[model samples]
Target: MAKDQTTRICCIGAGYVGTCTSAVLAYKNPSVRITVVDTSEAKIGAWRSRSFPISEPCLQEILKQVVERLAFSTDIEAAINAADLIFICVDTPTVTKGTGEGFALDTSAVVACVAKIVEVSTSDKIIVPCGTADQLRKLITQKNTKGLNFEVLSNPEFLAEGTAIHDLLHPDRVIIGAENTPKGSNAAARLVSLYQAWIPSDRIKTTNTWSSELGKLAANAMLAQRISSINSLTAICESVGADIQDISQIVGLDHRIGPHMLQASIGFGGSCFEKDIRCLVYLAESLGFRHIARYWMADLEMNDFQKASQTERITSLLGPLASSKLTIAVLGFSFKAGTTDVRSTPVLTIVRDLVGRGHKVKIFDPKAKKEDIQETLCKANLGRERAIVSLNAMQACDGAHVIAIATAWDEFRTRPGLRRMDWKSIADGMQQPRLMFDGCNVVDAKYLEGLGMKVLELGRKQAML
Candidate 1:
């Protein structure tokens, strides 16, 4: 591939991963003609617009710089035919039913994309499995392409939602998993060259196909496991009156453990962590490693328990749910701060549990749009209009008996105005003896108690009257 020549790169999916990856690639390598293809026209349209669909700070400016180089279309065949390197970035969600329902990845779309690639591409082009490699290998083997020649490479992306652009721009490391074959190694090298524009060559790591695939899953599992471990300790901290934050900070200061993803909150939530962990567990079980599977499964079970424990705390503080028709204010809905993604938000789990017991919920998040929250709630088979989406933090708190801070958005923590906003204004706006449940441990329980409001903070004992 010529350095100055326009290297055509086509990404199969236009979702979060596909869009962000394509944008960054275009931004980094202006010479590369990056075309992002998706089945959804709305998604493509959003990408074409100025106010891009996703709200990541500095993403719009970056997109603007490379808008000319980047193209969005629903025409996959045209994009694939003209592309020198094709990235299969479609969703490989967990299978719901069948033999490998819970654990195995559903690769129907990946297969379809591969078939399309085989049909269209004339030259021996590199086909990179941007998705997980293990699942793609199964599909490749099943198809049995004895005649056609193609280079398959595994180049997994490790970008979080909120900080995807930052991660992509300043990646810690770029993993390229290729076969020992010349063609496979060459393809991996080609992909590495693309990232060499921004990322250091030394940061680029190479490994076998299986190792790369399992590495992605293992990385996420371990990140989530750390969170679950901290949360599990939060329970003991609450019982023993120990400060979870202080404990986390002190433990994180050690060079071995390090301080990252240690901040205690409701639980871990995102598209990757839980799904990947479950996939890892399933893979282990299939390989006759039952003990390994059980150990991994325990991490997820602990996560669920942590979310459920919050609901239990709410009921314990607020008294019986049968007689009290309490109005609950949810501070945040998105899985995490800085992004509007609610893939597997612990807030949903908490809301479902509360609603199941007949409590009304009112939600508010600065970044999360109304439609996104509504769609998430609808898909979860929860009420749509039952929860009112507020414009500001104070508005959401108004007219609510209890305030549950689920997502630890920056505004939830350091905003002086949020703290100063009279709980009396909230109380007068609602029923008497207002309750506040700090699910994220962002609020100061002492301050709230001084305001004469019943405050229950996670990883701490309830405030005494």
Candidate 2:
């Protein structure tokens, strides 16, 4: 593969992964023309807009650098036709219905993209499953491609939502899975050459198709398991009146464990962790690894218990939920900070539990859109009436007996205005004595207590005074 060759690259689905990966690739490889295609015109338009849909610190600068080279469009066919390499970065959301309901990937869009490639492509194109498993790609290729000849490769992404651009620019490794066939090997090499512009050759790992697909799931499962493990410790820590953060710090100091996903919170909440773990468990069950499935299933069980435990604590703090319509202010809806993504947020679980127990909830998030919160809550079976969305933190906290910080958004921690407006002001404006539940432990419990509010913190004992 020539470095200066006009290799056209098309990535289907201008999502968090696709947009970040395409922008970085175009930034790194100036010779390549990267076109990102998505079904949602709004998403594509956002990619082309001044404020990108997703918020990453260096993403906008990188996108600006490759603005000329990178393109976002809804014209999937045209992008596919003009491409040497087509990356199917479409969503493989967990199946909500049918055989593998609530666990398996809904590969309808991926299959559709593959079928479209088979139907429209004029030349020998290299098709890469950019966001999914190699098994899915093989299944799609086998089912859709009869006469069509295309090289299908697996190039799964491991970019975290808030820090996607950074992850893409400096990835740990670029794993490319290719078949033993000449076309497959050529396709893998072509993909590798593009990454080699920025990434060193040593970091580019090559393996058989199955390993590559399974590796993505395995990595996520392991990460989620770590979170679950720490969360499991949180329950024990609370029971024993021990500090989980201190324990985590000590545990992380060990060379064997190290520090990564050791921060304990309400629970693990993201699109990947829970979904991938569920998929892995399902995959194990399907393969007759019942014991293995049960083992992995415990991770998910622990996660659910972790989140549910918070809700139970909230109820315990509030007391007599049936007797009162509790006005609870929830800060931060996104799973984590620095991004507007609300998929599988722990806040939803808290909100649902509160609402189910006849509590009135008012939610506020700095980055999350009102529609996203409404949609997420509705999907969780808690509606708009049950959960009121507020634009500002003050408004969300207004007249509320309790303020719960579900996400560790930077704004929630460092904003002086929020800190200065202490419990006295909040209590004076509320129906009852104010309470603050720091689910993320972003606030100072003593400071809040000084202002005459009850402070409940995760991973730390509540001050008896």
Candidate 3:
């Protein structure tokens, strides 16, 4: 395979990574044919009809442009047989049963895909496994009945939930890892050429197989640690009556610290941070590094503690939850802005506690689907009786004693060309002694206080009581 040549690419698993990657490749390299295969017919159907399963900015627009070159289907075997290169983008979620129950990654889906490829593939192909590189190589080598040569490569994706399209189009850096053999170098160069179509040559990095795999895990761990560190300081700030935002500004000013993930909020969430941290913890523990495991494990513990502490503070302010049947309005349901991913979101913890204590909770998000929110809550064993989904923020805030800003969306803040939320109208409709818990610290607390709403902001002293 050479650059500028039309190569058939098959991506196994039409989830977030697979779909976004296939679309970008198809858009950048129009001559190359790419097909995304998944077992879920509904997901494939949704893509075919332009009804995307997940919400991401600029994703649909790019998908529309590459519709002629990119295809979604349920026929995995046929796509595998016809492809010269295959990408294993299947989900490797943390195992929830048997061995490695909570922390270790479960790569069963990837294992199954390997079995199918080994049975159906008839030609030499470059296999890019996104997870468990060593296990994937072992599985393919053991199951190969025919004399077909397979070159295994580790090409893990580094995509953030909301900015996936931009990350794909102009990634900061791309890591491709393969064996240090002649064939491995050749395969790495071929994939590099595909990315070079749009990405600058300097942005792509090639390394050994283990570094690529570990790099993905370590990158998420580092980001999650920053979030936990800032949150841990928020507790001290509350005790000392010092503002966390001020501290963040001063600390982030340091050239070494920078100002990326230093914002103090309720906690970090989404599919990556907590899951990847746990995987790292498990990896350390498995290697007999007890101290190392404990250090990484604290990041996850601090995240949970931050969420629980915020819920406790809100509930304590309401007196006894059993005595007061207060109506609370939750402003956001998704993990963060620009995406509708509810996995491991902190809002779930707060709302679950409120509803379980007999308080009514009304939730709203700009882009999160009502069904997705309901499903997430239901999976957590949270009943829907006291937890309701509102059509708009106004409906949720009406007759509510407290308004909780869970997700920090740009619309919630005052931005140019965007109409700010009508807090005066919302405050007027809310019940007396109205309170606003700015979990994300997006709005101006002083401004909200002027509207006669008591503001309780995270990482700040409680003085507006």
Candidate 4:
């Protein structure tokens, strides 16, 4: 393709990564025509309508600006037929069964996408996996029968859910990994040109595909390890009556131990952290690095332990759930605030344990859809009536004996805004011996206690009232 010609880009799998990347790419490079295609008509339909399937801050505004150059469709072949470059943005979820079950990412979807591209593509195409392994080149080489040239490149995305748009617009760095050959370098440079539209050339790093793939896994693994390490310290803090926040502040001051992902909370929850760490674990174990695999595997064990300990703490305080028959209000469900994704939310573990013990649990989240919450519960075999979804925090807290702040949302705190939760009003409506559990530590513990409510914040010790 000539530099003068408008680049035609096709992104397979119009899920979060594909949609966001395509929208931002089109917004930055107006000359490029990008079509995001998915097999799911519902997802494509949602993209076309006012009600988008996924939610991210500033995404809608950016999508609105690039509407002229960006398009969404269900026709994979047609998009591939027209595209000069195709990005495989399909989901590579952790495999549940068979070989490598519970640890390895199932790349079957990516493999199928390669076969489809090989079958439909007529011209030389640059194939980039937004997040994939290094085996793509071998797969394409074995499958391509039309004598068409396919250049496989690895360009993994590293955008956090809550601040995805900002991360994309002002990324710390952009990595493009390709083969060391001339064709591979040219393909990498072509991809770099698209990013150079907005990103500074110095911020973009070019490397071999293997390192790029391993780098993503290593990064996520280290992050999860840090979170687990902090959470583990929070447990010791609670035992010794030392505030984890203060401990974190002191430790973070050290230049060697910077402060990021060090804030104490219920536990880390999302799609990436656990999945990526497990992938690293599987890779380590497969190569006979048993000790290394166990080290990474311990992080996951610690996360689970943290969640279970929190549930046990709450249950112990509330007494036997069968005899109590208390109404427990749970605030926040979307793992973390600013996004509506609940793949591996840690709070659900607490909710399920409470409900199983016969407690009435009412839940509310600012951004999570009620239906999605119901679906997640139903999949876990917890009936809709088992855990009622409240319309708002007030509704969830009404007539409740205890309130638990699960997700760290800005509205949950006493900020100077209309959205700030009125704790006094909520406390007035609660049953006697009112107790509040702060999982994310987003509340003013002193103020809440003054309202005759017992506050139990994680990583902090308080005398029994």
Off by over 4 Å in 4: 3-6, 130-133, 319-323, 415-419
Give per-model TM-scores.
0.94, 0.93, 0.96, 0.97
Local accuracy of candidate 2 as per-residue lDDT tens digits, 2-40: 433547999998887888888888988888899999989
Each model's number of backbone clashes? 0, 0, 0, 0
> What digit string (tens of lDDT, one per residue) describes model 1 on residues 319-427?
5543577778898999998889877888998888878877788888878888888888898888755666678877887777778889988676634666534554665
Candidate 3 colliding pairs: none
- 50-81 per-residue lDDT for model 3 (tens digits): 88898888988888888788999999999998
TM value for model 3: 0.96
lDDT of 4 by residue, 310-350 (tens): 87777666654426777999999998888899888888888
CA lDDT, candidate 2, residue 375 = 88
Clashing pairs in 2: none
Regions more than 4 Å wrong, model 2: 1-6, 130-148, 320-322, 414-424, 463-465
**TM-score of model 4 vs. true structure:** 0.97
lDDT value, candidate 1, whole model: 0.81
